[model samples]
Target: MTDAELPEDLARLWRRPTGSGSRLGRPAGLDVERVVRTAVAMADAHGLAGVTLPKIGETLGVTGMSLYRYVGSKDELLILMGDSAFAVEYIDAGAAGSWNEGLQRWARGLWRAYQEHRWLADLPTSSPPRGPNAMAWMDAGLRAMRPLPLDRMTKVGILTLVSGYVNTSARMAQQLEQGWRQSGGVDPALAAQRYGREMARLVTPDRYPDAAELFSSGTFDTAAAPATATPVDPAEANFIFGLEVLIRGIEATTASAALDTH
Candidate 1:
């Protein structure tokens, strides 16, 4: 089924906070589930901007200040929201195959996850993945590649490449989707034409001759690509381009590691 039609169980997952042991982190009666649920629904309807502690309070029939009692500020809520939305439940107990194959599957699943929840792309990578969900995801990724004969540093490098690609591609797709919806379903060709016009106005051939000629020829189709198409397909050309880069980077890393060992 499409992500929009994801089962309630799956969708509500984003609202569930990580366990705080037997001791309650806050007052005895905070309904984290309700807060997250309301926030997720709001985000689905109005992008990330729609999510506010007060707005969520309204959704749950509580005052805005009531929310701060359970969660901290909006930033803290966002951290929780991000974790809930992107949390990992189970690292495939049945994961099977060569380490590289396993890694590729993990990466692809992450890419799909971001696609399913477009907001994942919107979440900033300000610091390393600290939230429980993100950490769980990172731990799973390292576990998947645990069989590889590489040092911790190499593993970190690989993680960087994979994570960067996922974040960049998913976000680009989100922006494109937002624009499409905002423009009331813009024409792909016309949108490209407009971008070309804008570039023409901003870009001068004398300074950027090659860029001007490239856009002027209309051979380079930015509108058809991820940057403009709201919710563009993850299987688009750029996605593939990124995948190729990941594969090549992996191959290169493996070779380099082998050489270092030898």
Candidate 2:
């Protein structure tokens, strides 16, 4: 779509009254928020691909064409739904003690939301967030970093990195969980063991010494999993590790910047 379409879509999502004569005399049975909420429910129940205008209209007891009165298009509907789905009070930076603590809380909250709404990771982000809730979440993230010695753009970039990691981690976890479910509820630990044995039988140490050594190191052994694993969810330990590493990088960068200014 052209850049010209973005403003119109944002207007539709924010429910700003279009002064156009086409929308001046609209009926009141449906509203933008309700339409967006319904669309979100549809997406949550199914996946993003399953959320079509016709399906949303059917669920709302209206014809597909009627939904256009509230939402400009399916693209507009998706923007609204994504904003609404993330419309939650996940953290309070003011009471979070320190910037690091607040940011950790923020990241964890976002991770939980992505887990609960698995389809959110599938939503197209070609456009920047314009809806109220989306902007609010962004504001919260910035607020969490208020005590940091970073520039505004740097802080925003930090949030982007944190959110990107959360989305990727959540998507991977979702795929793994779905695969496990598809395999008739096989325990992940058992699956790992079976895959390791198969790899051992297939891979030869002569040509692929690294692979063979990794396979022999018992790193894949879930039976000997660490007790102090981060995130408490074995499937999400990597996410925790990556989050901590990213936070440390940010701290180092900001600290260097501070020292340079002195």
Best prediction by TM-score: 2
Q: How many clashing pairs does model 1 include?
A: 5
Q: Tell me the tens digit of each residue's lDDT in model 2 across 1-262.
A: 4434556666666666554337554556677888888887877888898888888889888788878888777777777887788866654445788788788888988887787778988777877667777788888888888898778988888888888889888888888889989999997777888888778777779979999987776667754355564526766677888888988888888889999999
Off by over 4 Å in 1: 1-29, 89-96, 181-184, 189-237
lDDT of 1: 0.69
User: Once superposed on the true structure, which residue ranges of model 2 sit more than 4 Å away at CA?
Assistant: 1-6, 21-27, 92-94, 222-232
Q: Model 1, range 1-262, lDDT digits (tens) per residue?
A: 5545654333333443333234334445556655776787687677787787778877677788877655656766666677777747424545657776666666776776776666767766556666567777777778878987887877877888887887787778767867877998877666777788789778888999989887777654654555654675434557767776777778787878789888
lDDT of each: 0.69, 0.79
lDDT of 2: 0.79
Worst 10 residues of 2 by lDDT: 222-231
- Models 1 onward score TM values of 0.70, 0.88
